[model samples]
Target: MPLWLMILLGTIFGGLIFFAIFMFVRSRKKSKEALGASAGETSKYAGQAPPEPEVLAGQVAAIREHDAAFDEGRFLKWAEETFFKVQESWTERQASGARALMTDACFADHERRIGELLAKNEKNELDALAVSGTAIMGIESDKQTDTITVRFNAQCADYTVNAETGEVVRGNKAVGAWVEDWVFMRARPDYLAGGGEMPAGGLETNWRLARIDEVMG
Candidate 1:
């Protein structure tokens, strides 16, 4: 082979080897940096504290201790049933059926509202009422009364009709979602001295709905 040709071939091979080495080193450095960043991120997340779940659990435990016979499941079922029944009674313009399930003030308010509707010759009608979800949001008690507030998410077909003409006056027939907070109250008797028992037939003898407020948003 000619010396010039041999020298040219050697230079080309050396340059190729150097380029490969440079690329390999650059990639290795980048991999290390990426791995380090991932590790740092993991460590940072691990070091942060998470919110405690015990707060709500502790509150529930305290409420349980306050009333031994207070069954959460039973109360929730009763609340849901009462909610639907009250709505039905309201639409029917009769508070007598639900009066036993509510406080005096609450019943009076309901009666006044029904009276207004009657005077206006209008009636609110609800169909396909269903409780989608229910939860006890709060519990409080004093020397005389114990109140348990519950959140109810429900959907129904709500509309108003003119009583005289039997025609739709307001609201749509489409199903609409609504949220409400209902407060049920019971007299604080000698619960610690063995006193809390819901009447055999129903909660009408023990629990009375204090008030109801709609939840927005």
Candidate 2:
């Protein structure tokens, strides 16, 4: 999912939510780049150190201060759903469907790739997809924003085809798997917990997909 995961990591959005444009483009050689995308574009945070478990615990605790309702289980579900929808959009080379879930920068990245596919009348096809597991790697925040990184592990048959004749163009239709680190960001809410009542906001909104980094094996 090079241009994305369009999957763009929107391949999933730039990298399945990246069946990622990079996956196929990251294709590394698989179909449409598949979820098993290539390592084409590297995320800026790829090589940085991850927060230790203890630190991450503190980070989650801090997030709870901002969002008392933050739940890892529910967050992962959102991540999973985002992955599926972005992948679906990637297949169609349409990035808008996932616009609501991504930051403008992230959305732009996926959009650029989808546009390329449309210009060429090509489509990335990802199928037989299954997520084995998803987990958080890190969580942090600036004075005005919150950020979190999550890892997605999944498999699928990936390939690209000529939109008109359905001819195999660049990738193979073989099934394969991939791992990606998706970063999400959002503006800080107007209020923070002062040990008082928390906002009613759920884990949705207030956060948007920021970036996706392919985990190089």
Candidate 3:
């Protein structure tokens, strides 16, 4: 080979070798950086261990059992606590008010309208029977970003009072049946019944939806 040709070939080969070494070193550096970053991530996660798989299963099972029991029980305890607790005093007050506010014929006519089919039993101590009923309630499950709708049945016991004497007549239990539908909207939170006003007293009373936003529904 000529002298110039030999020099040129030597330079080209040397350049190629240098380029290959540079590439190898660059790749190794990059791989080390990546591995270090990955190790950091792994260490961070390692500090917080995952929950046991059996724990999740147990929680799910408990929730299922609670739901089943609530369904079977018809949420009677919830109803009694919510309904009677709020209305017990009001109902008794209304019973006392009825004597001064209503006349015998008016009361009798009201009873006939209700299909109670009662005869004039006695005067001084006339017994009255309010009844138990099914109450419709809506419960909600809340999260940071959303809410879920939950529905359950509840039963409220009936309230009774003496018609003429305005005394609570608990000798015989009084019960009624009520079925209602409730709707839940995500945007409203301050719903009320009877337009947020106090409920009026009556026999076998029906609960009216005044402000639905207040309800959990």
Candidate 4:
């Protein structure tokens, strides 16, 4: 071959080899970066430990120790009954019956709502109130108080009526199911007590409704 032709061939071959080497090095670097990212993600998740089951058990035991009458079944029963009574109080456009069953703040909220209804001459009526199921969602006790949150699924015939003429206004008479969470609170006792009887005459009770919130699915 002539000298110029040989020089051109050599240059082209060298260029091809260099390009190949560059591509191989770039690919290896990308692979290493991807693997490093994956490992970092794995370690991040693995560093978090799940809560121990015994921790929750210990919390419940502590709460039970504070109130000897702290039976889950009994508390749930009371919650169901109180739910109905609260609905009844709303229907009657009064809060007297539920006053003893609620905390001061909760009672104040109820009275405020009732006052608003009374000002508008309106009342809510709930008939055939039936609780389908109830579940204890959580229980906790602090230095001075114990709180239990319960979830209730119930059906009731709801309607808004005019207080003066007793006429249906807003809601229909059909029964509808609703989900609600009710929080109950009581003073944390230093010693265990035997009876679960609710205290009378005082605005505060051993178990009183703290708040109620609707749960949306």
> lDDT of all the models against the reference?
0.65, 0.68, 0.30, 0.63
- Identify the candidate with maximal TM-score: 2
Name model 1 segments beyond 4 Å from true: 1-56, 191-205
Q: Is candidate 3 or candidate 4 better by lDDT?
A: 4
Clash pairs detected, candidate 1:
none
Candidate whose lDDT is highest:
2
TM-scores for every candidate against the unseen true structure: 0.66, 0.72, 0.21, 0.65
Per-residue lDDT of 56-159 in model 1, one digit per residue for the tens?
45655666775667777888899888887888788788868788887777777777777877899988777687888987776677555677777777876666
In angstroms, how far off is 4's CA in candidate 2? 50
Q: Write out the backbone clash pairs for model 4.
A: none
lDDT (Cα, tens digit) per residue for candidate 2, span 1-217: 3553232232333323345555555554444233321223554546655557788778789999867888877887988888888777778776778788777666776788788788989887776878888878888876566778888778877677899999978766667776678887766664343232332322233677776777742
Models, CA RMSD each: 22.4, 12.7, 32.6, 21.0
Off by over 4 Å in 2: 1-55, 191-205
Task: Give RMSD (Å) of candidate 4 vs. truth.
Answer: 21.0
**Local error of candidate 2 at residue 200 (angstroms):** 24
